[model samples]
Target: MRTYSLDDVYATCKRRDSWWTVYFVDPVACRAALLVGNRTNITPNAITVFSLVLGMASAGCLAAGQLAAGAVLFYLSFMVDCVDGKIARLKGTGTPFGLWLDFMGDRIRELCCATGLAYGQYAATGNVDFIVLGVAVVVLDLFRYVNAPQMKRVRDAIREANAARTPPPPGPHEPLPHQSFSHSPVPHQLGALTVRSHPVAAQPSRPPRSRKSRRRLLRRFNKALARRRVRTHLISGIEFHAAVFVIAPLLGQAALIPVTSVISVLFVANEIFLIYRMWLFTRSYSAVPKPEKSREHAPIGGSPNV
Candidate 1:
């Protein structure tokens, strides 16, 4: 009897990266990691540091012209990455720092492996092209670094604006406080009793809604009942995929790098925008009135008033 939420949907999408058509996913690998997580000793960040060590050692070997060793090392780093996240999920001990480390380590490992490739090519051929490729990867990564924070700020602003527009919820978020929203009689002595409920829509439908239609609808349903926890997976995926396909093959693809880089950057930008969208949803939901409260209050004259 497993209860699922919006996070389940997003987690499913994210977990696709390491899933198997034939066998179970890397999350299966995380089972071992979870047993390790339960011990009073093993920490997620510790696992993160170990993954970095594997990545760095592999990059060192590759840069020194050890091709197979570098590839093995690179492979090991991703394996460790899976374990860390798996451990977090399995143990339910998610930490901000551990999550941040996992993300940073992934990004750094990609850069390091790209650098190792350039180094290997240059050292073997005595050509500057490979080295130049490494430098370009670093530069593009810096662009992403700069974009991330700026986009976060924009998202925060949108969340705040949406929050201001959506009135605060009428009841307790956790335990019900001593003071609560209540309804009093409408002051008419001989009138019929009436109740009011304004319908709140569900998640988006397949036919596709107009922008104005969807925006208003989402703002109504996205609150404490759901958190945008899965959004990190989304932005992370966009950034990771963009780096892999669009940014990684820049060595011989001279004319294509700029175009790919632009598309990747915009993809990241769009991911940021998606984050804002999720935040807006959460802000609206956080402020939505309770169902009973909606049921208790009726328009005095039947003319829809706030």
Candidate 2:
């Protein structure tokens, strides 16, 4: 067990639970979700399904030319999105599939919203405004999807680096028994096992050579790598939502067009920043040598990689 081993920062993130736990006002929500999740076997994926239904319904409202209603539904959709993850964490039902679903849901929501809005407005009047803005919508999506992978790579790199920077707790495993004890009065060929990690001191600690240290370090490394991935995916997906959310409505919210337009511009800036963040992760990830030998891969923003 080596002293340089890194801790699982992402695990801490997961343990923290509640989607908005870091942002406060979520402790109460987290407790409630945990209570419900504990009572029922509802996994994170189940909540995702609920979110999807609400989102689709909102999209339906938007397509039916109910802008205000659509807006409210959209808000609920976002809230559901937040609640499900928190519940998953509270229930300890966060699985890889659930994570993937959550990620995909966000992109789906963005795509549906902008595309549906375009569809709705066009069906109503076949206006040039919707037609013109459609180009922007497609362009934004293309960039969003295409850049996601690169961004993810960068995030992975960052987590790995961070984990290395912050070491993990030592393992408690005992060492293997010794082959034999040759120091007897009658030198016997028979050997005995060495007591292991339970009482670590008597356990002849192995340093990088130490089993406990190595295991702990390895775990941290993997978590860091995972964190990089989750963070990158989340940021890019969020950017997509931010774009569609602000710009698509700008088409009909003529009074707030200027404000919305500014937001859209900020989305572009966000894209650039995200790309930069990805580059950081990539550099950090590659800095660690071979993939198999490297530490646990953590997700970005303290989440573990799914």
Candidate 3:
């Protein structure tokens, strides 16, 4: 077994992670990954299974109305979840099955925990609102997971379509002004005349943009966010889960509804903003000029027959 150092473990972590993970979970998880990587024969899949067990135990505690213990167990489960990925990265022990297990396990854990929290609250207070909130939690989580990947695919498809319509860059072997070719079409071609064998159409130019245009403003905002390593969507699935499972419970039953409601609103708003951005992208993509069909024996230096 190969040994790994602390630095090696840290190196295996993602460059950018959710704020909750980066600030709270990572410091502890990095140490855990290093210890596990060097000292044991444990597989990443085993750690993942262990995380699932912790998660289920957490759900049981929550169901039993042991809110404090449940919160602690839930956080521990998240830490273990972070560890498995780090170990996989450090030891190169990751598998496709491991990835699938991790993803599905997260969904199940959240579902069970949501049900546990809501049921426990309802049992104590006889309120139906908690039960409805539980269903909303599950639905929103599923929607975010389902929609995020499909949205990515749509964006990828749009990018590919745009790329297909764009002209390719010059080949490595293509002659530049500074370089000369051995074989010349013109025997004594010199200076600028050596470059072109055929006449290429001049690219159309667009008018300069106003400083206050929506596109320009968006670009500036994006650049500012990038500089800080911050995403426009501040609250993601990880944050949402943490808020519901950890923060809400720590604050007691009274805070649960308010916390969950706030996070849900933010999550939905971000998703809507993402969809709006995609709409803008599609509009721009549609506006791209398509190549017109050429007429038979068209003049090289003149317009084609109308």
Candidate 4:
């Protein structure tokens, strides 16, 4: 069997990925894991289980107020988390159980990390506020995790209903004489098509306009900013854990705890808003009357044959 390259593994296993995963973490860690995995009989589920163990160890370290050690273990667990999906894709060994285990592991890790970090902070600072914040973090995170799937199902249902209600495009048998065939080859009556070659035109170049160029740059920047905001709000599991455990601990900044807590609150609010919108959309969709099946099959009232 041929070994999968880092690029191949990444291409096959990448999810709705975050910038940290794409640009920083997975590039190095996942590559190394894939390289090791190719030489070993390690399965993706095995990796996922190992990651969960590591995450638990990380939480233990955090609870013991071993910040640096906890940070290192947390990152190590995340790296393993990245590798499991890649290994699954590479070996074609992904199962529903594996996926469920993976998701469960992520949620457990988040909860453990949140609780551990809060306890560690309280132990270090002797502040009850840390404990409260920690509990809030876990609750918000859990709500986001649990509600997200339900919201997705609602949105999907709405999308499916809308798609069903909309009429499909006319088939070849239907009249569509006005439709353009400029790009496609002309079809023959004998079920074949032939391309008619046309001469290409060279267009004249225009000088760049400073105002228009500035406007274009502004638009691009705004679009990129908007995308970044969305990705930040839709924070991935590893990203959130890494920020609180790894980055904050390394920086010796306990301020990140409150900051991340605030972010979690905002994220919860965003989820609530999304759920409301989805509910509204579903209600509106449900109120619309569907066409009767018999009427669909009936002839037009003004047909000459009728």
Which pairs of residues clash in candidate 1, taking residues 3 or more apart in a chain or in different chains?
A: 222-285, 223-285, 223-286
Report model 1's TM-score to 2 decimal places: 0.49
lDDT of 1 by residue, 1-306 (tens): 233333342353342341121023243444445445545455668888889989888778767766666656665666676666655665466699888888888777777876776777687777776676667656656766776687678667666666677755655455343332235333323457443333377977655468868867766544321342223233344344334332343333342235445545665676567667766755665443423435347676673355
Residue range 1-306, candidate 4, lDDT tens digits: 677677776676454466666666777666766786679888888999999999999999988888888889988888888888878877788999999999999888878987898888898889888888788778767776777798888788778878788877889787564554446554434346444444478988775798779979978876675554324334554456566778777766466566676556555566667777777877777654655456555678854335
TM-score of every model?
0.49, 0.52, 0.77, 0.69
In candidate 1, which residue ranges exceed 4 Å CA deviation? 1-28, 34-41, 92-100, 166-306
Native-to-model Cα distance after best TM-score fit, residue 37 in candidate 2, in Å? 3.4
Best-performing candidate as measured by TM-score: 3
Higher lDDT: candidate 3 or 4?
3
Between prediction 1 and prediction 3, the one with superior lDDT is: 3
Give the CA lDDT, 0 to 100, for residue 34 in model 1.
41
Query: Which of the predicted structures, 2 or 3, would earn the higher TM-score when compared with the native?
Result: 3
lDDT per residue as tens, model 2, 121-203: 67887776765555566677778777777677657666866678664654567433443343434443435633322223475
Error of 3 at 209 (Å): 12
> CA lDDT of 281 in candidate 3?
75
- Best-to-worst order by lDDT is 3, 4, 2, 1
Q: Which residue pairs clash within candidate 3?
A: none
